[model samples]
Target chain A: DVKVTQSLRYLVKRTGEKVFLECVQDMDHENMFWYRQDPGLGLRLIYFSYDVKMKEKGDIPEGYSVSREKKERFSLILESASTNQTSMYLCASRSGGSYGYTFGSGTRLTVV
Target chain B: SQQGEEDPQALSIQEGENATMNCSYKTSINNLQWYRQNSGRGLVHLILIRSNEREKHSGRLRVTLDTSKKSSSLLITASRAADTASYFCATWANSGYALNFGKGTSLLVTP
Candidate 1:
């Protein structure tokens, strides 16, 4: 089965610390995305990469960055973690067509 | 920003009953999809209805799309206790493949 693996399931970070969330997919999909899910906000895209070394900002990219050095790995970085950034982070991967995204289990991050 | 709004923020139904949820979007869309997410896990894709299709069914799930009205509905018949989860509706944009999701409808199936 196709799988998207998130390195961490739960995390606690200090304010202003640099946080990294890693994601890897085995399907060799061209598109990988990072989204933060809040209670009422649903899922908002943080960043996405279509190919290696190519990245694009989404609706809520402030204070966040992404890296895609390899075809199957995509990473999300929090430049300076803040308390407001505490939420459930989800990683998803999809191909070029109209198929639905295969999402990872998600990482619940708490910034204190 | 979210492009779709799901009606009935919460619903509770007994087992063997049918549960229906509605979603309305603002603009034209290439397709609409339904996803189910457990309490704290990732979302599982349920079904997708294209712009050209009016209705489609998979197992006990039925999805209907009305492009002219910019609306869609998901119906799950003979619901079970394991069907308790949050259901979200996402729309594929006319120009891009990125999906814009709605807030979601929380459903509970009691024994």
Candidate 2:
């Protein structure tokens, strides 16, 4: 079975603090994505990387950035956490051009 | 911009009844997919229907797609309490490498 792992399941950070959310996939997938899920807004893509050192901005990438220094690992960085950034963050990966995604257990982040 | 919108924001039905959810999109898509997510967990893929196909079935699930209207529907027959989850419809557009998801329809199956 394919596995996607997130570094944390739940996290709490103070306002203006820098935060890092890590995701790792064991399937050697070429594509990795970061999305934020919120009530009534569904899942909004923050960023996605098709390969190491390459990243593309998604619809809601304003306050977020991504790093993919390795093929199996992807990280989401929040430069300065804020209250509005509190939400469920999900990581996903897929092989090649496949349309289906294997998701990691989400990390629920709360900025106090 | 989001490509799809699911109808009936929430649905409640008896355990043995059937549940149907509708999703409509704005542009041409390569495929439409349905996913189920429990309260706070990750989503699991349920079914995928391609644009060239009109209908498809898997076990007790049925999916239909209409390209002219750019809409799709997912139906679960003989629903069970264990099937209670939020259903999301996602569209893979021809222009992008990502799937655009809708606001999901929350389903509650009571026994």
Off by over 4 Å in 1: B93-95
User: What DockQ values do the models have?
Assistant: 0.74, 0.78
Q: Model 1: which docking level applies? A: medium
Instruction: List chain A TM-scores, every candidate, in order.
Output: 0.97, 0.98
| Candidate 2 error regions (>4 Å) | B93-95
lDDT of 1 by residue, B15-94 (tens): 99999999999998777899999998988999988899999999999999988899999999999999999999998644
Relative to the unseen true structure, what is the C-alpha lDDT of residue A58 in candidate 2, on a scale of 0 to 100? Answer: 88
- lDDT per residue for candidate 2 within A17-42, as digits (tens), equals 99999999999999999999999899
| DockQ score of the complex predicted as candidate 1 | 0.74
Tens digit of lDDT per residue, candidate 2, span B11-99? 99999999999999998888899999998999888899999999999999999999999899999999999999999999864436777
CAPRI-style class, candidate 2? medium
